[model samples]
Target: MSDRWRTLRRRIITPDVSETRLDVRGFHVKNQVARDILETVGKSFLAGYAIAAEAKDQSIAERRIDALQPRFRGFAYEGAAMAYAVIDGLSLWRRDNSPRFLAGPGDRHIYMAYVGIGWAMARVPRFRWQRLVLPDPTLRWLALDGYGFHQAYFKTARYVYDQYRDPSFTWHGGGPQSYVQRAIDQGIGRAMWFVYGTDAVRVADAIDGFDPERHQDLYSGAGLAATYAGGADEAELQTFWQRAGEHRPFVAQASAFAAEARIRAGLLVPHTEVATRVFCGMTATAAATLAETTRPDGPDGDQLPAYEIWRQQVAREFVAIGRN
Candidate 1:
């Protein structure tokens, strides 16, 4: 095994008994902080998505724009770009005694940037259908294409750069990109397995050499083996899989971009296709189902809301992809 992986394995499998609880506590605190940051960002993203979706409705008359246009006009593109920049900057900040609860200033900046982008997109007078094209569909594809790439770039760059910022850090388990990709892939499999007869105990045991019970504190509520012990009914699993298939196009595109970025960064084998078809299929199914159920009026209903639909869709896909 690579030294980095060895180190991580040792840390998990044979932790120093005296320091075990302390380490667990540290991890929990950091994780909670991270979760909070993600939640805030997610909410902001959902709001932006909803506004944009409303603007995209074909049925809405031009006069209606007077009321809704101002809702997102100020931030649209600028807000999103700023959010990306902020995230990039925050990830690079270094300070001693920084509270784990708050992300670095860069985090706040990134949030602002995203807000700006959303506002701009939401406020555009004509709904700019050209901006929605993807995968080289049109001359405007470049702008749309950059959106995901920018997000991934900021996330991966921040993570990798953070590790490197610490002189003692070593890159391991393939590399950050590969590691993340594998986790995403395996997470999907594990989640599916969990739906079958796998339990938290089994998952914990499956690791190189860790005591399941001792590590129980590391898990979120869903991580509890007891939660999955009952196993999902076959019919439910089948239904989920069916829905996942519909989202294949979007998932495939995202995975392809991620894989390409990893390869270009030399973080993984140049030829590796880190994107998994199976996982994409599963996640797509879940996303489509969530979109349908959560926004029955399509992306136009005020009652259900557009951004909420997008958020639910993303959440379902994330769940279908499993925990990473």
Candidate 2:
């Protein structure tokens, strides 16, 4: 499977070595593996949820997720993390049966997972300051693109009420969950960076309308997006970095993580040279060197030393730079 992924990645990434084409024919092939990655992680989440549900303890689910992290690999590892958010959210929901945990964007699994994070945050006594706020664009896209799934899940299946249905229940009846919403919205912003490529102005504008309080979230999303799908000139990215303000280091680190994740996923190639240079302040060659250094080639159930080295180098560079 790894070899096959390499082959597919080479076919798409090497052919153009310029524009990252999303509309090209056979693009679905690229996503087939991504979909598989999502599925595998989803199954794991369900299994974890079952354990937590049976034990009547959410910590059981958290422990299951912690145990599975080293097992997660490849480019779509972050996607798996997203799935775990759902399990975590559901675990909390099963424990307390709170309405907040019950709310989500219907059955859009990704959106549900995002909402799950919000749900978890709401119930967790630790992060009480965090609010549940879904950004406009996140809602827009999920409603538009995922309407069918939403309708099937919310209307027909009634997933929100599956475990416990209240006769007078309404989605958002008790108000909204903001923290995870911002996080997910930030991820959407990052996706936009890739979708729009180097069009920094457009990406910035899209998230600009968001409330100023959420700029940090937007910047975090923008940083990861720029790192992975960036094509903007340095000045444009610098402007973005400045907007992130004190959070610039955070954004930069996320960018480094994005770069490494892309490399591990087998999606990185010379074509993304511009992104590496702009976001990481490193030549594509240098960035690729780190990618090769960090490639997870260890035996299953084993930790790889290269992974730590890559992480340390990324952290050191970003910390030294401090901003941008």
**TM-score of each model, in listed order:** 0.19, 0.37
Candidate number of the best TM-score: 2
- Residue range with the least summed lDDT across 10 consecutive positions in model 1: 132-141
Model 1 per-residue lDDT at 301 = 36
lDDT by residue for model 1 over 29-129, one digit each (tens)? Answer: 22333333323333333333232223222123122322332312221222223322222223334311112101332122222233233222223322242
Each model's backbone clash number:
27, 8
The sequence of per-residue lDDT tens digits that candidate 2 reaches over residues 59-139 is: 443444446533232212222222233333334333222222223211222333333333233233333212233333223
Candidate number achieving the greatest lDDT relative to the actual structure:
2
Model 1 reaches what TM-score against the true structure?
0.19
Kindly give the stretch of ten consecutive residues in candidate 2 with the minimal lDDT sum. Answer: 143-152
